[model samples]
Target: MTERRHDREFVRTFFTSPTAVEGEDDSAKMLRRAADLRGLEAPDVWVPDNEDATAPSMREEGAENVAEVVADSGADFPGEIHPRVVWHRDDPAARYRGFQQMLTVADPDRGAVDHIDGFVIPEVGDIDDWKKADEALTLVETEHGLDRGSLAMSVIVESGEAELAMRHLREEVGKPTNSLERLFLLVDGEVDYTKDMRATTPTGELPPWPELRHNTSRGASAAGLIAVDGPYDDIRDVEGYRERMEANRAKGMTGIWSLTPGQVVEANTAPLPPETGRWLLSAGDRRVELDDRDGAWAYDGDRLSLDETGDDYRLRVGGDERRLDAEQLREELLGLVEYVPSMSDVVDSMEEFEAARESGTGAIAIERAATLRLDGVDVEISSDRMWDEATYQAAMTPIRLFQDVYDHRPDQREELEERYGEDVVERATTVG
Candidate 1:
């Protein structure tokens, strides 16, 4: 497959206070902290809360600190590190001034521009906010004679109206010239949404507002923008935080926001597996033919094919072939099955199972497993059985057993038990 320009590895954002304390430099401290994090991809410095703090002065200090840090530090991180500054949302003119300062203070010789990235706009909720941000960015680019899309931009989606704003952004200002790169979805904003809908419960249990988060995430993905999950407020509940991160990651989020430094390691260490199913081959749309030679398989062109005969089948992809044993085949099949529409529901329900495992909620696991089994029935029926019956059986048998277990179809279960035996059914239902 052709690579997408924006496809990047998982990003971990570390947030730091903007202003310095009495005797310490905040920017220096943040840079040192980032250097210590080892795997941190981005360090975001928050703008000062005081309305009196001048944007140019703050930008000067931030830029100077970035330059000093890069000069002092060794070449440890591979890519360019852009220390981003969080812009003040209420003051559009000040935001414009900050970008101007960023350009002015940038030292080309020292690579200061490479280290000091761009701006992050928080709490973006409407078309007006987008317009103001766009205007400020435009002004900064024009004033400084900077190239369009020179700087990266991130916006926070924290309110109910964010979905509309996101759609507007996708249409009006996207890609090439647009500086907007990331959209952060904060969970705390769900409270505001609940309040707006009058759906808040007395027991502190709110409705499943994940649909809002999903909407924002899907919108970002469709627009080819990075969707970042907001920080988890409960610092003590690391497990809960990781669960939410995993769920969001499965839904296609590229990064997670962290409130504390401790969460950075966990966030950065989260496994982000590359997409691994399906392959397209051919020269000018001509289908390549696979020929079986002895126990191995060979393709006419530089394409890949899976040898399905032996227990340890070899899969060839673009001149590379690797032997996959039974267990590996099982794993590969599970991943491949996700592409099938009939199995997608089961795959989605598996997320709940995983989240429950992380949260230590045993009851939810059982419930989700039951749902998985019910969905598995649909998967079994819709799966193609005519082509390569053994492979088809390999893929669908587990799904059938999973369905039989929770489906409680006694006759069907008994028939499958007689055919496949009790041991096979138990193994398939329990683990598949």
Candidate 2:
């Protein structure tokens, strides 16, 4: 028994290191360790990983990869849920990864907040029709469920569109039915779009630009697009990177895309983790406070912002601190605000979304408009919306049946629980 007590204490050490990344086995060990530390028995099972792990929601893998968690920013907090993920499919538009920035202004007339999920830069390289090559946005409101944002037109100078997107989003904030859940941005140039992308229509802003989040914000924007090709002849080395952050912080380009995984941590961290100054990957669910909305702001595990001054908040991961600007004064400071989603909702949604990919009926189309727009010619559009019709039809058989299954949220909950287990199902919640 005495030895058992020592074993219990040993296990608790890893249970709350506050830096552990949860995986299939890791979470279970954590739960068991936590219980053992307290001389209690862990639940009969371990926590699940991903959507299949829980009721579905709190477990949702954002609408797209590299998403900003709308729920608790804290990865370890009891009530944290990963919100919707989003992204923009790679196209010629992606080439301008760093040079493009969309300033969306909320439509003042709508009197509602137009939360921006992400932005797309048009590939004007050859394709013309603005709409065809333009960026599409996804803005979520509790009412509309999860749908597209209001603006998606191509722009001439990056500055003009950037301003307008902001106006439109803010304008829609006051409307009666608008809770403007803010945004869900997908940042990346991680992957390129190809004719073979016969899966689900690529839904996102850009690819992962872990560097950009570290830049300064124009306002309360969640995700943003920025082009960072400064002729700073100095930014070729590690010191150059740090120097660039200081300079850009002054100008407001937080981070850049031309980054490596190794560089990610240095650009995202505050006090600069001993390992990497970047904190986005290194320190998650850690407490932090940086500048935002003018003065010093705080993110109470739930809402993030400085409605006033001196709000003591915690760093919950997801927010990046590196940038082209503001690297001058290095303070071992704060980080991320958070959001906790419902237990099964996100998981259910993900399962349904995956099933929907099986539907071959919704393919990409090159309408007469697109034909008029394309110059390179060989424009092939698929109705599969990215799903492999043959495979989905082969496995699921009934297309309609599978399509319908994608719409069922509750069923996904059960599926998730049965597959991944309960660790995911029992994450932190803001519902109460």
Q: Which segments of model 2 are wrong by more than 4 Å?
A: 1-163, 184-216, 219-237, 252-261, 269-432
- List, residue by residue over 1-432, the lDDT tens digit for candidate 1: 111223232343434433322346354575555544432333322222111222434555655665566555524433334444334445666565555545543445555555444445554557666556655656655665666556555565656666566666556544555445433222234544565567866688656566766776776655655566665667799998778877875575535666566675466444321112222224223443323344222334434345655456665555656787756744543333222222333333444454555677543421211111111111111122222323333444325424533243232355445544576455446433
| Best-fitting candidate, scored by lDDT | 1
Q: Compared with the true structure, what per-residue lDDT tens digits does model 2 show for residues 1-432? A: 111101011100001111123454342332223222211111111111222122223222212111222111222222112111111224433322211212111222222223222232321221222222232233222133434434322221122223234334344433444323223211212223221222244674333323322321332232232223211222247666665555544443433322322232334321111211111212344444322222222223332221211322222224533321122111222112222223243333333445555564343221111110011111111111232344333323122222222232232344434433455433211111
lDDT of each: 0.47, 0.26
Q: TM-scores, in order shown?
A: 0.50, 0.23
Estimate the overall C-alpha local distance difference test score of candidate 2.
Answer: 0.26
Compared to the true structure, candidate 1 yields what TM-score? 0.50
